[model samples]
Structures are given as structure tokens and as C-alpha cells.
Target: MPEGPSKTAEYVATFRAVESARPEGERLFSDPYAASFLDGKLRLGAALARNGMGQRLVCRYIDRNWPGSRPSAVIRTRLIDDAVTAAIEGGAEQLAILGAGYDTRGLRLPAAREIPVFELDQPPTQERKKQRLRARDGDLPSNVTYVPFDLLDEGVGAPLERAGFRTGLKSVYIWEGVLSYLTPEAVDQTLAWITASGAPGSRLVYTYVDVALLKQGGEDEPPWSSQVAKVGEPFRYGLDPAKMDAFLGDRGLKPVWDQSTLEAIAQHAVPGGRNAPGFYRVAEAEVLPDR
Candidate 1:
């Protein structure tokens, strides 16, 4: 983990903040707590985004700097939000969010408020989020249990168990914007933990980049790659969307829903007016019963 909070997390929060600032009829989702996690110019920009004109200006500035990143993040957020809601409605008793930096789902989603939420991330980012939440809401939400641990050095099982995560419970895990930052070993370990620790019918909602993009071996890196690398959180893993079903099946998961970033944006965002990176994908999978 970086010495400070995750910059990418703050960037995603800024994306949600900007989206939430849109008029109620036009916004995809509302994350009222998202802006509180931002800093400096981003905080100012989110503040200004409360009006339609300000929203367009902030989006234009973000697009100029990050190309498809803002739209991709926004769309990804809404997709995951829908998946989580569906999971809750399907009887998920718990929610475990891996790399949960700056995410406000536990507080913002009413369905999430009905169950216990485990928010896991690096110590610095977890602390920063909690501090911001306390300042804004006077206390941490009673339903959220923050688990601060280094993803590189530790597996989630022990920490989560210590934090009162019950095994064999119907759970929903959100691995949003986190897989690309982990080593393959860490990723596999996490999957193993989720399958071993969660009961059948549990759900996992995650985002990953196309492995083909990572292995293409060209001078042209994806536009967002450089930015993450500059912040010391470079992408390290991706799954081929073509083989994702087989991959997850081998790991005891059944893929139920999958979509490319472009597809999600097209489905959820205003039509003919949005462009987002297509290499990023989101998937929802169900944990299979052990043989």
C-alpha cells in the first residue's frame, strides 16, 4: 500500500461526486458522501458540480486529463450498485467490500444498511475514509466494520473472521476497481477465501481489465495505466473476458452477469453522448456448492 490514501480511490470518489451532483432525473446514482473523501482541487470541483453548468465543466476537465476514465468509473459504480441491490434482495446477509477505499455503499445504499458490511482496504485508506465519515456524519455507521490490512502481506480470511465475518453465511462481495492492482497469487488467494468462507448462493461483484490488453505488448498503453503507475498502484492482473466464465467456473464460481464498460455505459448512461474504455469489464458470479 502507499504511505497515504489510495489516489485511485479518491479519483473514483470524485467521479461519483460529480455524477451525484447532476439533477436527480439525470444522475445514475447518488453518493452523497463521495465528495467528502476528495481533496484540494477535486474537492473544489465536486463542490462546484452541484449545478448543470458546473457538472459539465468538471466532466470536461476530467475528460481532458483522463480520457475515458471518468465515464468508465461512473458506469462501473452504477453497475455494481445494481448488482449489490440484487444480491441483497436475493437474501444476502452480509456485504464484504475488498479494497473498499473511499466507497460509501455501506452508508449510501439502503439495502446495505440492513446487513453487516465489512470494508477492507490498506490501513491508510481505511483510516482516511473513517475520519472523513466521522467528520461528516458524526460517527461511523453501526453496520460497517472496517478491516485495515495490507493486501500483499495478508489474506482476508483471518482479518475478516476476527472482525466477526461469519462463514457459510449468504454474503455479497464487491471487488470493484481492485483486481488489477493485485498479484495473481493474491487474487487467487482472495477467490479461495471467498469460496471457502462463503456459503453457496453467495455473490461476488468485481471489475477487471481484459487480459488481452495487458498482453498485447505495444507502445500504446491504456490511457489510465500511466496515471495509476505514477501513483505507485500499477495494474498487475487481468482476466480475458472471453475465458472469464471458464476461469471463474474452475474457481467454483458461476458467472451470471458480465458486461464491458462500453456496454454498461451505453445501457445506463445517456445514449450517443458517452464514450468509455471498452477493455474494462464488470461481472457478477455466484459461489458454487463444494463437490
Candidate 2:
């Protein structure tokens, strides 16, 4: 068997494996396609499992604290699920996953099969993902499409639009685990493009970390924040819930949901305690016409 693909592809392939390994765990996210996509990527699977152990530990902690609700992992899963639901409810016929990597929603979700699912990523990332999926005999749903382009390039939007995505129809844009890798300017530009390119009722679900956590001058903070920074993926953009509202408001987006760690834990039944120190944040909003 060919040795999997690029780093990004391998990373995602492993994520699928870990997600699959959780027994009766499919109910957590129910991604049956994960295992198949991970075949032949044993190293990736092992790596993902190693990383996921920490996450699972956190989830277990959250569960001990916030019983009777979904765990933090489930909460994160629902965040994405709700965004997809909102898009469908808003009459969106298309869904675009930016920095798609090895996302399996196009393969696992029935609704995704009904609506066109576009996976956007760099050429190498996209090519490698396709190779892995093909190797596993993974069948992409008929509605799935792949668009390759660098998000930083000015021409990014053109290729997407040319590949059957239109500004006139409602769409859902998912940017999971992506914005942290970008600069503030790039983040703004990406949002601007989505606002300009999506029709009314379209929505965006993206994640980011608090900027205060990124700054060294901040008061007592979690060790994980600094640790993540040392890993070279420091959180660059932090949004004051209010500031985020205003920022998106100016861009014609209506903030529908903003979740803090505690709030997400409560809402999703995550088990970690407040002592665990939350570092990641997720938000969802809709593109509305100028008021």
C-alpha cells in the first residue's frame, strides 16, 4: 500500500481513526466513514490517538463536572452540526468547507449528500486527501466537489465561484481548526470574501482562541495556552464577544451564537472542570443584508 499523503492529510486521516476508535463512540459524532479514510495510515492513527487521549481526558473531566449533557467533544461536534442545520433551515443549497483537509462530512452526512458539498484547500492538501480516500475505496457522495486554491491568494474566490459556487444562493461556510493558522489580516479578508460572496441567510461557523491568552502580559493563565504557543500555533485573534458582534455586524453578518468554554460545557455536557482552562472558542453567524 502507498504510504498515505501530506502532513495535513495524514493529520486528518488520524483524527478519523481516533474518532472511530471510541466504542459506541459513533454516537459522539457518528462518523462511520472515519475508519475507512484512515486505512493504511497507521502512524497517523497512532498520532491522533495520542493527541486525542488528552482531549478525551478533558472530556472525561468535563463529564464529571457537567453531567447529563453531551461531552465537550460532542459540544464541538454539535457546533458544526448546528451550523449545517442552520444553513439547511435558511434554504442553503450549498455547503463549503474551507481548509477542508480530510473532512468526512461529505461522505457521512445524508443531508450533505443532498446539498452540494464543496471542499476547499491547497492543491497539495486536496490532492493528498483524494489519494487517501481513493486508496481506502472511499466513495465521495455524488454532490461533493473539491476546489484547490491558496486562501491567501487574491484569486481564491474566483476559482471557488467558477467551480459552481455562486454569490446569489444561500450557502454555509465551515472553517474548522483553520483561522488560528492565519494572520489577522487574512482572517478579515476571508470573512470579507464570504460576506461579499454569500447571499442573504448564508452562515459561517469558525473557531478562534482568545487574544488575551496569546498575550504575555495577561494575568494568571492556563499553562496549556503557553504550551500551545510553544508548539508554534499561538492563538493570534481573540474576540471580545461584544467586539466580535460589532465586527461581524459591520460586515453585514448577524451574530447568532457565541459560546464560551463554560457555556459550551454546560450546553454540550462537557465534563472538564473550570480548573482545566479552556483555550479554544467557536462561533456561528449569518450573513445578512445591510441594515
Candidate 3:
């Protein structure tokens, strides 16, 4: 946002991964290695918040202050994780994560362990992940490759190709928690590459804020936009819900799964959930095979 990898990206270190590291009853899932991405203070807080009200309190405060922040990220992470796992089981190969930031899926997911993991993000943030990863564990996974680049400045196809990404490989392209912060051109270019390069049956998963929420904002835009702006990251792009099916078709992709934060919570039986409309949406789209 301000410089390097987004300041907003750091929250993945705390909110999504770190908290998810708790025991199953406390967490929807766990990411033990995600603790490596967190700083000392975050580590301490997360440790104190490993279960019960302590954990709920942390998320409640964030949700109260910044609506849709915690629930969206948490549900989106779980959804992405499930999608990737299923794809791998179905014989997918290559894995690419755009704006990976502090995500630990490459390390933590069992299906991902044997596959080539290509992570793309800002140079500084990528380096920081490597440093923290090394400090936390000792060595990088042999299958993991880091591509240091900006999607706004450069298209993913070239850099990822240089990183040993093969064309027409059945792969999962993950652009988690990042689209709203990017320019429209960046979004289109990335999707173009994913749709064009993916082998038959490949798919992409990404999260986006609702366009209507930000467009006619009297209540939604003020707090959400300003809160993100305070961290030097502001919402720049969104997908229209009504046009999404056609939108995917235009890019040579087809919608496979779509979930709003409310739906995700309902699916997961998350308690005390608010049915907030115009919040966040996570969608998975399949790359239509070439005729």
C-alpha cells in the first residue's frame, strides 16, 4: 500500500492464519506454520487467544471496528483451502498464489506438499516471508518458488513462466484477499493469463468486496474505505454481483462456486453471525477449455 507489500497484508499474519492455528474446536482449521509470519506481539496475542472468548473477543473487536474484516478473511481462507484440496485430489498439478503475502497454504496443506508452489507478491513482502519462514523453520521447501513482482506493474504470465510455470497445466490460481486493492487493468491482465494458460478443468479462486456497497455508500463506504485508507490501502475495484456470470464468460471462465460471507458462515455454522449484505464474496471459476 504505502510501499512494498501492503501494510494491510500483515493482517493475514494475525487474523486469518495465526488465529486459524488453534485447535479444531477453537479454529475452523489450523495453520501451525502461520505463526512464523506473525511478529512477537501478534504471536503473544494469538497465543493468549488460542481458544474460547479470548479468540471470539479478538475477532469481535475487529468486526465491530471494521465490519466484514474478520469474517470475510476467515471464511475466504477456509473456502480457498477447501477448493485447493479438492483440486489437488482431482489430479491438479501446478499451484500459483497471487498476492500471496503471508499465506502458509503452500507449507501447511497436505495436498500442496508434493506439488510445485509458485508464490507471487511484491518483492519486499516476498523477501519478508522468506526471512520469517527461515527464522521460524530453517529451510525453504524445495518445491516452493518465489516470484517477486507486482501485478499492477507487470503481468503474471512472464514472471511465472520464468519461475518454471508450465502452460496448459491443470492448476489452481489463487488471488485471495487482494482484488479490491488492485487497479482494473491489473485484475483483467491477471485473469487473462490464468484463463489463457490453464489446462482443461483448471480453476481460479479470488475474493472481492461487493461493488454496490462501495458505490452508493452512505453507511458502508465511509468506515470501510477510511479504515483501509488509514493503513494506506484503499478499495479500488469490485465485481458486480448481477454481472458476475457474464463477467466470467467474457474472460473465458465459468463460475463453479460462489459464496458471500453470510453464506459461508451459515455453511460453517458460525455463531452470532450477522447477515451483512454488500459485504465480501469468494468465487471459484473454471477455465473454459479451448475448442
Candidate 4:
């Protein structure tokens, strides 16, 4: 995608870097390694965000252009972090992150580090991620495995298995910030694959945009959509949050919880701050035992 690492992944990492730059008490999650994945203007922006004034300036610019992107990423990161930790405590034996671009969970989460963590993404992005990790930490964590494959070209099963992913173990899969760029068929295939490959109690956490917005945008595309399209990645799939239960159920998944960006912002963000767009959301579901 885009001839190299995904630009959107860097953007999400930049958001995390800026959030991590916040004072210890004010930050959602501490991802000290986020800044290591950024470069150029993104790198400078993250550096400037270390202080309150600069943080506001950087965040304001982002909010003005992308609305809820920064806060959504920040809040979703924490949400998924909690879900992953809970999964491990609930007996997850392995963690698989599909489309895992620049995500530092395996390295930052103590619970995740205790078990095998599979990071799967397109080859270019995965390679860049490895290079960045090696450069920043001198060596990648022994617990994390990187699997590279084209998301649009192939199913994740073979690549992941080749990378040491084992089925029949209760697992947690994180497919964050990736659904919108894939076709609906790909999305359905992935959900079904997870059910077929993970144990009965496995969990899958993912983020998606609302289908209404995707279908109703009509002639006027949203700024966020156009911005991402300009960089080669475009929004392609969405699901109605109201139908999440049925949507997951048909694929052998039981919905656990669905949280909108607005909900995440209200629950976790500082009050009177920029509001995250409600249409973007995160949801988690567990693999249903075969009937």
C-alpha cells in the first residue's frame, strides 16, 4: 500500500506519540515508543506536543482537519489495551494483531509480552516496523512475531500459521484502524477466518466507521475520507453499529460490547475538549462455540 509503509499508520502513531507526550496523569496510555515510528513533520509535531501549549496547537490543527481522529485513536488504544489484558487474564494463549502497523502493544503491555504476539501486516509496512523497532530498541521483543502478507491478496491464515500462530488456543485478535480500507468481502472473510482459526473463547477487537455515513455521504465526501484517499488509502467498508450483534453472530462471533468514538471521548477524554466524531467506533466480540 502506497509504495511503502501506510501513511495512516504513521498518523495513528503520531496521535499516540502526542498523547504519550501529555503529562503522566493526563495521558490515556503511555506508549513511549510511538515517537520512534514517526519522521519529518510528524516527528517535529510529536516533539512539540510534549508541552501543553504545543500539544494543544498540534491537536487543534488535527481536529480542524480530521475532526475526531486524534482523540478516537487515543481512546481506542486504551480500550483495546484493556480488552487485550482482559483476554490474557481470561486465558488467551496468544495475541494476533491483523493489519498491525506500528502498534507497540506487544512491546508495551506486560501481559501481552508474557505470551506470543503475532503482528501481521503487508510486507512493506511490516518491514518498516521491524526496522524502526530494531533501530529504537536494538532488538525486537522475543515474544512478538511479524507476519507479512498483502491483506487484499490473501487470507491471513497461511501467513500467520507460517509465523507460528497456533489454532485451538484462546486468542485475542486486534484489527484496529484497518476495516475501512478493505472491501466488504475481505472484512467478512477475515471475521470468518478468525472464527475458524481461533479457539471457542477467542476475542476479536476491531474498529469501523458507520455504514450510514458511508452510504449517505452521497456526492459530498467527508474531509477525512478525501484526505486518506489522497494518500492512496480510501474508505471502503463500514457496518451499522446497531446491527453489530447479528453481524458478528452470523460469523460465529458473539458481540461483547460496542463503543462509539463519542462514547469513548466522554468516558475517557478530559471534559470540555474537542469531541470525537460519533460515527467512528470500536467493538469486541468472542468466538462462539460450534453448535
Taking all chains together, each candidate's TM-score versus the true structure is 0.97, 0.77, 0.92, 0.96
For candidate 2, what is the total of clashing residue pairs?
A: 10
TM-score of the candidate numbered 2? 0.77
Question: Please, what are the lDDT tens digits per residue for candidate 1 over residues 39-81?
Answer: 9999999999898788888888888888888888888888899
Clashing pairs in 3: none
Local distance difference test, each candidate? 0.89, 0.64, 0.79, 0.88
Order candidates by TM-score, high to low.
1, 4, 3, 2
Per-prediction CA RMSD (Å): 1.3, 5.7, 2.0, 1.4
lDDT string, candidate 4, 1-291, tens digits: 489889999999999999999888889899999999899999999999988899989988878887778888888999999999999999999999989998999989999999999998888888988999899889989999988877786576888888899988889999999999988788887887899889998999999999877876657666778788889998878999888888888889998999887887777764223567778899999999981
Model 1 gets an lDDT of 0.89
Scored by lDDT, model 2 comes in at 0.64
Off by over 4 Å in 1: 270-273
Local error of candidate 1 at 284, Å? 0.5
Better of 3 and 4 by lDDT: 4
Off by over 4 Å in 2: 1-16, 23-26, 36-74, 217-234, 269-276
Q: List the residue pairs that clash in candidate 2.
A: 26-30, 61-271, 61-272, 62-270, 62-271, 62-272, 63-271, 70-268, 72-270, 211-238
Best by lDDT: 1
Q: Rank the candidates by lDDT, best first.
A: 1, 4, 3, 2
